[model samples]
Target: MPQRLVAVSFNAPTSELAGRVTGQGATLRDIPGTLFLGGGVPVAVDGTSIAGIGVGGAPSGDLDEKYARAGLATIR
Candidate 1:
């Protein structure tokens, strides 16, 4: 799950749980592709993505995303 989260965070403009699912719905689960699940977010600088972060084991996707964002804040 953490691997998928990281994949989606780095590949998509936003996380799938954030409502921006990448590719086709069926294809979303494909490995080696954008996982598009959730609990992930991109690390951006001046509006461009430089890296990505993901969180797992949170109670919910929202919480995971929040945690990821918080992690990003430290480096920003």
Candidate 2:
């Protein structure tokens, strides 16, 4: 889900993309393939997104996102 989110975020808005995905009768967890809720964040270098990081096993999706952001911050 994070991977898909990052990919979609590259081309569209993450909030809107999430809404569209949910509107289509699918969830971040229910989507077929590698999908995650809020742990996936794109890694950008020099204003260019080159990769992404995904964190899991957190208590909540918000925590996962926070953790992922922390990790990205370290790299920056």
Candidate 3:
């Protein structure tokens, strides 16, 4: 199966954690034209990243991550 990319918005919060997440995500695949934000998380199954969830427009990156993780919980 092909991997999917979902980009809802680009207004993710700017913070130290965000920078770390972005850096880590960027190095994971080392792909060009990719975005790594604080609220974006990988959905891994059996140690493989099958999908991702991205949330934005929240007051903080932590809150955005909370919502994203909540969505992931339902599917898991």
Query: Quick one: best TM-score, which candidate?
Result: 2
Clash number by candidate, in order: 0, 4, 0
Worst 10 residues of 1 by lDDT: 13-22
Per-residue C-alpha lDDT of model 1 across residues 1-76, encoded as one tens digit per residue? 4533454445542455435334566443454544444567776667656667877678876687778778878887
lDDT by candidate, in order shown: 0.59, 0.60, 0.53
In terms of lDDT, model 2 sits at: 0.60
How does candidate 3 fare on TM-score? Answer: 0.56
lDDT of 2 by residue, 1-76 (tens): 4553564346332333455554545455365664535566777667666777667788976677678779879988
| 1-76 per-residue lDDT for model 3 (tens digits) | 0111422222222222234444434442355555444566567767666666777789866787778778879999
Candidate 2, TM-score vs. the true structure?
Answer: 0.63
Q: Rank the candidates by TM-score, best first.
A: 2, 1, 3
Alpha-carbon runs more than 4 Å astray in model 3: 1-36
Model 3 lowest lDDT segment of ten: 1-10
Answer with 2 or 3, whichever has the higher TM-score: 2
* Model 1 TM-score, 2 decimals: 0.58
